[model samples]
Target: AAAVAGMRDNNAILSSRDWARRDVLMQTKCAPLPREEGRPAPRPLNLVQAATVASHAWPPQSTCETLGLTALCDTVRSVAVNREVIAAVSNKNIFHMLQLYVNGIKAAGIKNSMVVALDDETAAWLKVRDVANYVKVLRSRTGDTGNHATSGLKFKVLIDFLSVGCSV
Candidate 1:
């Protein structure tokens, strides 16, 4: 009851229609506007200005490149299945677990599985093995050492996949 009272005081409650209208307004306000012909590119926003921007700009442009989201989307499209199976692996476990994992998926006749390689070496290894078709190398900001290090990255990976319209 106290929580509900607090939320009401904060104006946090709204009807579904009100929430839908708010969403439309936010999308309209935050969307990048088209530049008029011959107009100079807008100056880059300073730190303060950027910080003030809406959260809707999320999965920022740099994140897309760093995660190789476009490539992942392409790989997902190549699979005919409605859902995709993703295996996130770093070079540390490539030899120890990748083959066994891939074999299991193959034995099950799953055609939509793909690997999200956490390092360049893993990507290279996949290419050399001629099984790089469904692999997408995700560039990590900090070097990922093992499963523990990469575990925290799952949410970000899932967000990027969602942004690209892929279902895992």
Candidate 2:
């Protein structure tokens, strides 16, 4: 009850529609007006300011380039199942996107038998397979008695210290 009263006191309970309308109005003011033909073109606005030029049609190519996706896309495309990371992405046309990823992976020389295809799950898992090899290396390092001062350190103070540091 007190929280509700405080919100009313501060006029903090604005509707999303009202907020969106206000944002659009603010952006419209920042846009440049038409000028005479003889004048030099206006200087480019910074990326944030450029967004105001077309509030309804923002998130343009420049925005994606600004975020370093141009370089990232090439590398991530080899491993990424879809346009984005598998765990955090969704698609309106999931079937089409999945087909694209599968085709891309297949074209990259991955065997069809190696790729897993399920109704709700599909992945090449090449990188994931490499990661499993890394896990094997890590396990070997921990068990390598030749390098360690003692044969077993599970009960040692150094192991406790390492575990504590890891938790932090």
Candidate 3:
């Protein structure tokens, strides 16, 4: 196949591991490093750098605050979150980074319920909702072309179901 041959031709420029590491939040050389003093190493930081830091901090919420993210997590009639949302993300391994989104939040009892869990930061992010209340599940980048937007798919309810599955 041309695609396979092209990949072989460009092997010198590509690392097979790159395909696996793409989704990872890699630390930059300028970022903090471990120190013998039992503290994080001093490193350059900026706004974008701060965002990168926040997502991996001990508690994700603190990271969001560190970056001064304007997304307010609050109660609304409905909210949308990318499936990657997590309340307390943990990296067990390269492939085991837990996505904290609403489901994990509920599982952790961080909030009484997902619908009511949106706080000041997450609320501000609702504008870019992925599913926007569920009528139609967010379509895959490659899926059916029905283009039919169904009605009445509740995200909170679905999140609850997902939570239930995890408990089992």
Candidate 4:
């Protein structure tokens, strides 16, 4: 509430109709770039780092290794995550990697229903996305707060896949 009020008051005092520096996006890394003829030197926010949290899942854009996603990704207005060349990640700590990948994706708002197979050599990829965009279009309203605790879910995975899947 205070932040919103501050911006409103600021817009009035500063006679200029627009100020890029004070965009709310500044607080979150999601701020859009200013439209200017001259390019500003690249900063951390300017660069979209592929939020790769999976220690076992192949690094960013490894999902693009296939010809299909790779080709489709190019037609987009801009690219954020593209993991085409990377092979599926393999590690002794597969569960840790999965947790990090899941948490990191939560941080960036990425989601997907890629079913992972235990014996399959290829790893599935998930993409980060903005929930607000989808939420606005949704006519129904419900509490959307999500829980990130992995304490119980970890046990379930281990119990369900013990004999068939990776032990880690």
- Candidate whose lDDT is highest: 1
**Colliding residue pairs in candidate 1:** none
User: lDDT of each model, Cα atoms only?
Assistant: 0.54, 0.30, 0.28, 0.30
Candidate 1's residue-wise lDDT over 20-101, tens digit each? 3333334444333455568799874333213343344432545557666756655555652433445544454646687777
Which digits, one per residue and each the tens of the lDDT, describe model 4 over residues 1-168?
123524554235554766643445446434333534565665533212233444234222454343223322231212223321111222222545655654544454333212222222212222222211100011112322122222223343333222111222
On residues 105-157, what C-alpha lDDT tens digit does candidate 2 reach at each position? 44444321122221122222334333100001112235442323222322232
- In order, what is each prediction's RMSD in angstroms? 15.8, 19.9, 16.5, 16.5
What is the Cα root-mean-square deviation between model 4 and the actual structure?
16.5
Give per-candidate clash totals: 0, 0, 18, 11
How many clashes in candidate 2?
0
- Alpha carbon lDDT at 144, candidate 3: 30
TM-score of each: 0.50, 0.16, 0.18, 0.23
- Model 1, runs deviating above 4 Å: 1-68, 132-144
Q: How much RMSD separates candidate 3 from the native structure?
A: 16.5
Per-residue alpha-carbon lDDT of candidate 3 for residues 1-168, written as tens digits (9 for 90 to 100): 122212333224655665632222132312222344555666633222223332223124443355332132211112222212222211112112122454334343332222211223323333243212111123324543222211122343344323311110
**Candidate 4: segments with Cα more than 4 A from true spot:** 1-32, 35-37, 40-92, 111-168
